[model samples]
Target: MAEKPGLVKTRQERVETRLRQRQVYNERMSKKRRARPRSLNIGDVVLMKNRRPGSKFKTRFESGMWAVTRVKGTLVTVTKGDEVVTRNISCFKRYHGAPADHQESGNNSDHEEGECEFGRVGGTAEHWLASGNLQMGEGLAAQKTTTPGSPVPNQDDVPAEAPAEGSNSEATRRSGLGRYNLRSRLTLPERLRDYVCE
Candidate 1:
């Protein structure tokens, strides 16, 4: 049989196409985890990592519950009863622990003994974060007053949770004091620049 001229080249092209498809699939899988930070208003019930398991990893869950009055970084500062927990994004599963029914028809929403609706806080979280402190003490210790004059917060902007002493100033800097003095002549996209944190 006559040898084909581009058979080898054709096979190489096929492999490259498959590799690109696989990359797209992997990107899509990770995309779901990258949810945009939204307004987690006060009193909004949220779930966090349940680290205080009595036993080993065999019988532990990650569906911690609390109410959000403040949010910073990936942490949503929440208060549950007398205890206030500031959880990193890892320890949080928003919207009532990922609606059980929204998942599958067979899975149960209720928390389990050996596992949980969400997941567990991995060791990497502690490694990545400097302060994972939970304060449920006196009035000043619990409340955050980062905003100037400590004006009473309405619905969207709750009373500033007690940020670390210098943290507030840092937050202010990060909150875009530098960006204000940008080249005023530069034109920024309306939607792109309008991420006013409610």
Candidate 2:
């Protein structure tokens, strides 16, 4: 059989071109594979991906966030109450805000554990904050009175008067239909003189 001119050359060229294209494609994919996944340290908060198909309107993530107790390779461990679960790294979505109360306990042991965790305990500051007595800004504590007359209310609004037994004024105020007449003087009608006498 006579060899065709340029057939071998063209075939060699086509094979070489295919090899080069494949190498380029592989290099691009390798670079992408080398790209780092999101790093989740211990104590990080994460929302787990719920594999169970929920209603179309329901969210993909699990309800409430879970705190990362341990991370091993591509797996993460999360706890809820006494229940613990280990899931693949791909199954979790990073939580951006403050973590739940579980993470707060880890904050106290941060020094011992050599890692600072997010969240805080319910301390005196938090108590005062809840009670709404915590004052902020400069001069807030220094200012004794909110206005000219009223103080910051360290004590009761009305001062404790003497017991009703000994004082004549207290006895009269209590004995008089001051007890029975619940209506204030300002509310009394001006034309009720005849009714008052009756």
Global local distance difference test of model 1: 0.50
Q: Which stretches of candidate 2 lie over 4 Å from their true place?
A: 1-30, 33-35, 99-198
Give the per-residue lDDT of model 1 (tens digit) for 1-198.
888886656777999999999999878876877756465654455556567766675433443345566777766787755677776756665543222222232454553555323223221122112222222223222233333234334557656677666444766566654445344446667886875433
Kindly give the number of clashing pairs for every candidate: 5, 0
Model 1 residue 2 lDDT?
89
My TM-score estimates for the predictions, one after another, are: 0.27, 0.37
- Put down candidate 2 lDDT per residue, 1-198, tens digits, no spaces: 999886666777999999999999988997988856559867665678878856788778776556677889988997554468899988887665332222234236524444333333322222222333322233333243344223345457758777666455656667655544455544556787457532
> Candidate 1 has what TM-score?
0.27
Candidate 1's error at 197, in angstroms? Answer: 76
RMSD of 2: 17.2
- The candidate 2 region of ten consecutive residues with least summed lDDT is 121-130
| Candidate 2 residue pairs in clash (backbone atoms < 3 Å) | none
Tell me the deviation in Å of residue 54 in model 2. Answer: 2.8
